[model samples]
Target chain A: MNSNITHDLAVPLNQEDKAKRAFVTALRVHVLQHMSGSMKNRYEDYVKPEAQKRGNTCDTPEHIHKALKSDFMFKAYSSARTCAQEMVFDVVSDSVDREFETLRAKAKPVAKKGSLTLDDSVEIPKSVSEIDVHLAPGSYHAEYTEEDFATGAVYDNAIEVFSFGQFGKDSNDIGMTLSNYVRLKFPDFKPAKILDAGCTIGHNTLPWAQTFPEAEVTAIDVAAPVLRYGHARAESMGVPVHFRQMDATAMKFEDNTFDVVFSSMFLHELPLKDIHAYLKEAYRVLKPGGLLWQMELPPMNQMPAYDNFYLNWDTYYNNEPFYGTFRRQDYRKLLTDAGFGAEEFMEATMPRYTFVGEEAYKEALSGENTFDTLTGRMDPKGTRWYGFGAWKK
Target chain B: MRRIPRKRRGERNRFFQAEGVDELLSALLRLSAEVSALKDRVYIAEKVLEQQGLNVSDAIEAYELSAEQEAELAANRQRMIETVLAQFDNSSDVDDMTDENSKIEAAA
Candidate 1:
């Protein structure tokens, strides 16, 4: 059942970008495997022992960071990772930039049944606008042209390279895995209207539409470029998704709307205050007995202190300012405060659909071969996404 | 004093908040790419010469390869296949699937 639409899932890249993308892909593997291991060994062998000799408990993120920051291996890994992150964008940016005019023209009149509604008045939040999240130049919302979709294209291609093909080739694992989990676990629950908040380029958004064909799926993001690109991408894939540029903090939807309000890899991008606001908005928009699930980085409380520090490296050095703060929050309390009862709240881990095949995924769904306990140790090879939410009753 | 802009403007990572490391990596990458490109060209040239009924060894007139040299090179090739080609070959299968999907999308 191939939906007929425009555009290719594998973006059109010239020879140079192709080579650069390959280089970036190999470099990511090298950095993650070799360089990351060296850095960890340095911490274990030298940094931790030095801290212990100094009579300091090197358990907290601050203590760990203090001990590891000056280490050369740590510096090399950090720098290489940062460069690789930026290179992911740089390699793809050229291809998108080269075809900007033609791509925009082609996208504007895609003529798919799915719609794209952009509200120019929506203010770009400081968390996204102030810092170039993930060191991506021009951030997500910045529009260089009247019909610009380059930022979204940049992100789409960049993420494919960054994940090293772990995000199910097209970077839809988060959405597909979570949606599949919901389907298997709550077999009786059928969402009529599904909403994906902060859906960048709608990579995760399409899975819901495919998973629940009867449901009318809507995905919203503040970035016009991503929204525009997402709409075209969805149309090209023949998935009908209504993509709108709207603030997640204060959505324009009426009360008791969507049956399933979901987000993926989005909450960490917002400040702690905005996270609360977003949760409240999620509560406001969700109908009675509706599900509000968020798939994001595992909270700090779930992991050991060393793992917390290791994960929080992004907060201090990866341009994600609120990552550390958001992870430390008690999510169960946040859900309860947002009008969800304590009994309704649930937190679980699902293996990324990209790494584990359908059989293991089914095993995970049936409460067998679960990876929730291993959430403390973040493993790229054995990838698992952490999710938490509550039913609005 | 500097009038013309340099070809490679060193870009810094905002998060790392440091320099030199990324710059060094980039520098090394350029040399690595050059080496790889040269190797690629030699393979291409070998193929072209083979098709033209002119062997590269015949043209070059280099020292004769000993049986020991041949065995060592074969061993090196085997090791490379196990180490490098094995990982990439697996990834390429997934990549091919993605490409097929993209082709379908394009056709649609």
Candidate 2:
């Protein structure tokens, strides 16, 4: 009776679930990540100009998903989406490995490069300063020269792509789907200033522009390559988000400047202490009543056996050392410690499809397992979300 | 099928469990940090070794932290364990992931 045992349960997973798990997650991951041409061609085909024009990167999520309806495009999205993260991981990991070798060979005698050499004090921080932060090298530090700065971002982005897959804009729009639910539930859920930090490739950040068309949206990360890629993506998609290379802990913004500070799947990659620092920083940067939010793995206490197993898979062998730790902590208390008032927190699991039943999600509000990654396999009634919500005091 | 062994439970949890934020984990983790540091130390120490077959402890003088430093580091580690447990006893954020759902591309 170990729940982590792998297999589909009695819950009849439909075609969408099957495609997500079987085809996209499994088959597409290999091609998009390990192979190059196939993924590039597939991405171009999936996001043709016509399809992008139809997709609303500027409308509300409800309108965006509703207005952007092409059966073929949606199907292609489904096909390419799961491979999204896998491809990022493949590309970035391979690039970093090759580049790291060059870095080592060059630095063996002295810690200097040509016109691109980094400053003297600028050193790669030990990976274990706080915890075993991995699946990434060069973990976001200030650069001295032009070349090392580029090298740092290149390594970081490569690991991200390897971990994330293709970094596709369509897949990144999943957050906007939550915006659909938020809009329906709280029609007044509007924030004037939105920040998506550590937003590599800008795919996740662009969804915010669509989610709140009125909000001024900006996305930041330490890697310039992904920022450049994200910028081109924003220009091509016409989403109009400002992308910059910046660290999460020390973002280049004035205090209390944002109504909403959000990040997606970003916390677990950081060391535990770094997570605490980022939370404190988020509290510092948010407006008096601004909300702090994220869409990420569910807590460990709320997870069922199989779901816990699913969450564990990445943490174990994937070089993502801190992911499991991030999922297991009490987010409500964490937010409270960071500054939010108690009992101000809320969690929800948005519906999977327009017609999906509600019985599974009825008890979503009081710390259910909906938003957590493994929620599907564990909670029989279906999870609403492992979400914890709160408003700034 | 097969179960993961206790020796490898940490490894199992690393891969399988949602990231648990156990404060007590730093208890065992210190050893890993030491070993990770040692890997680099040993690599460089061996390179700087003047003679053949010097032990890791003997080679330590050639590197950053000596054997005496490691032992003292171990003592400081003991004090940290008690302090960590006493202060943050049950106040662990290691078990939670859902606060408020934001917009993102998570499969869940």
DockQ of each: 0.07, 0.01
Summarize candidate 1's per-residue lDDT along A1-393 as a digit string, tens digits.
Answer: 011122564455543455466667766776666566666777888889998898868988888988887776676677667766777777677777766665665566456868999999999998888777887776778877676787887788777777777677467888998898888889999999999999989999999998899999999999898898888888877899999989999999999999999999888888988988999999999999899999988887767777778778888766888988888889899898888999998888777765687788888766633334345233455567788999999
lDDT of 2 by residue, A329-392 (tens): 8888888888888877866555432224234322232233343432422222232322345677
lDDT tens per residue, model 1, B1-107: 21111122223543234555456655554345554776699779989989999787545444444778656744543333224322222223335645766898999
Candidate 2: what's its TM-score on chain B?
0.28
* Model 2 alpha-carbon miss at residue A47, Å: 46
Give candidate 1's TM-score.
0.80
lDDT of 2 at B57: 56
- A43 in model 2: Cα distance from truth in Å? 38
Number of the top candidate by lDDT?
1
Error of 1 at B9 (Å): 14
lDDT of model 1 at position A329: 88
